[model samples]
Target: MIDRRRSRRSFLKLAAASAAGWWASLSPAGFAAEREPHRKPIPSSGERIPVIGMGTWITFNVPDAPGPMAVRREILGRFFARGGGMIDSSPMYGRAEAVVGDCLRALDRPEALFSATKIWTRSTSTGREQHADSLDLWGAGRLDLQQVHNLQNWQAHLETLRERREAGEVRYIGITTSHGRRHDEMERIMRSEDLDFVQLTYNILDREAEQRLLPLATERGIAVIANRPFRQKALIERFEDHPLPDWAAEIECENWPQFLLKFIVSHPDVTCAIPATSVVAHMGENMGALYGPMPDAAMRERMVAWVGDL
Candidate 1:
């Protein structure tokens, strides 16, 4: 569950004061945690990653330009500066891989990056080709987690992924689906595959996963990555009009972004939530979810009831 600050101006004030005691600023009433952000373990290898990761779908597909490229650099800067890990991207996202690589190269490649990408092609042979291309584009020798995007030709790609995993060319292998589509298939696959992670759409509004996929992942011991957490910011545009509930401070959410992200990442079964953005300030706003104590089961119940009513 997540809490909130009333407005964007107030949130900016918190960001402005981030040079010192920024963690304290994430939650009013000074509810910041210690220096480190929250992290959860990958169930398979017990490798821990930050609760708040990033996604590069539409946001990182930038034209090769000084102006656009510089903005991306600042975004990555804020991300790493805030202790972010697990950057998820797909070759299907046009130039996002290259732009991310360029920005990472400019920043000297953050060691904190948990590089995640997907093989999106339909043919297993072409999926292998895309895997190699993705490495070159992202300038990575091996992907930390490689998923079969949208489960396209998933069976064959999973085999290739397992092969790479065995060869130390990949650390984790998984599958992804979005927008609440194909859960039956996802469930079937999850039950069968020797997967390390699974990515899906799980948010306050998209709670259908709570009924099945999340619980199943927990039972199967598969790490989960939540995508489209804001429903592509449509949820924010809808809920920002309403005043944040009074209990928002209890969970340390200082803005709508934090509120939404915390709701997803705080789930016991969810390892991380990947929210994409191009704005540097928005990146900071998203990372704010990493601080302070997370909302407990009781508070999460309250959040659902309050937001559902609104």
Candidate 2:
């Protein structure tokens, strides 16, 4: 009979070796913890953007967090170093634009950025002026993309954005909707408007977009930017106790965060997923999703089951 202790030791060694080999196969970009890495191209424009980008909503809006904002400077530096670039913001996200501007100005690497912001307001003049203020705050001479926030007076704002695009003030213009509650409205805007990108919420838990918005975006040749990838921490709460699915190993997901992020970004129509993070380590793991094996449809279905209704 084989010695039980010896058998256990041998099994442990084999497991360690397997894990090492799996890590070796993963995209080294996120693992190195050195810089922002991983990029996906916009199908519509063929312009590649970092697969993982930052969102400056709650994190950059602290009333007295410029000191903390300085920490974000280091984070942005690391982002630029690792090949990350896209930074999405909106006037509604108060003070976020200013903080981002401060960071970018300090970094002085405007060329490395894929700057994006949204126009929010009913009046065309207010929207246009807000757009100009966003430009000033970001310190970017020409914005990369502009989206109408929630289609609020989108018609008027789209005209303003179009004029800006014509004047070389911005490169791309689009729209955004979240919570999956506005799918019908989002669809109408998507179908009627000439948009280059569409920002919306899509994840394993929130597949509403998959039924209509995602397919529509694909058919229309519009790029998709996935927001709320973690479902506002719902994913972590649901999966914290559950063991990582066995197949998750196939995608190099050693952690739940990586698993969720990869699942959202795996869709071919998804140009990028902007998962927000204030913690650097969390940012590192989120970027890891950008690298390594993305879930195939079958795997995604399994992933949905593994995290069902949770």
Candidate 3:
């Protein structure tokens, strides 16, 4: 009745068209377009955090007076738009906590934040009260994560946090240290305490973390949050005149800051990295690193060698 050959040819044509469409949809750019951009998942918890987050240290601790608050709002807005929600602050950062609170109020984006702050005093009561005040300042009834700022009165605070974490007041508890000088102590604390995350300084220039702390954290299945990814601006100053190595292009790094950021974050143990920046453009550039290719072990070795030459 029907033309069998014609029907077969039509079916084959339709199948080829459908397959082409499917392949187009599965293409790399198509997949990237459909997916939200973020990298670095917690090994223990399976929580995927954007590899690049904002840090509120000196830059964020700007005067809580009228004019400064207005400017910070823009910075906060940019950070939010770029998928950067983890904001690290502390009592030591002076009025940063209050300023961030004002930003949150101005932005009305509380749920969009992965709020992180520290307990930086010396007594258990002081630490507990400080944390409570941080919660109040941020206007978040519960803290997403809190850390012992530089291990100051860490044991006392850790005890309180362990109880509170069980009671569900704090979702995660950890420790932090900024300088390479205290890394030994940081490692000791890591061994002694059960922590959810450990915040430390790690950048291209400061590979001290590679020696022991990072490896130990990975072994213990502890998450690592890198602070001072710019080395407090030291890396930029040191490597400014020198052009970025050609190999860096393979890892998607465009400049020294981004190169250093990628270097620290490329470590398999690093869960997330927070690079503080006040400028919106810089924030956008940092967020870009989260989307592109991350360095493999061989690439990481090459990266280290490249930096070593600098």
Better of 1 and 2 by lDDT: 1
Error of 3 at 297 (Å): 1.9
Highest-scoring model, lDDT: 1
Over 4 Å off in model 3, which ranges? 1-35
The alpha-carbon deviation from the true structure for residue 150 of candidate 3, after best TM-score superposition, in angstroms, is 0.7
TM-score of 2: 0.85
Clashing pairs in model 2, backbone N/Cα/C closer than 3 A: 35-82, 36-82, 36-83
Q: Count the backbone clashes (under 3 Å) in each candidate.
A: 1, 3, 0
lDDT of 2 at 128: 87
- Report how far off residue 194 is in candidate 3 (Å): 1.5
* Cα lDDT of model 1 by residue, 28-92, tens digit: 22432336789999999999999999999899988999999999999998888887988999999
Put down candidate 3 lDDT per residue, 1-310, tens digits, no spaces: 3689889989999999888768755653343344466666676577777777888888887875777787788778766665666888999999999999989988996455888999998988988889889989998888888999998888888998888788877888899999676898889888877889999988876778998999999988788999988876677778879998887888778877777777777888888888887766677677667666778888878877877897
Model 3 local distance difference test score: 0.81
Candidate 2 wrong stretches, greater than 4 Å:
1-38, 64-66
lDDT of 1: 0.90
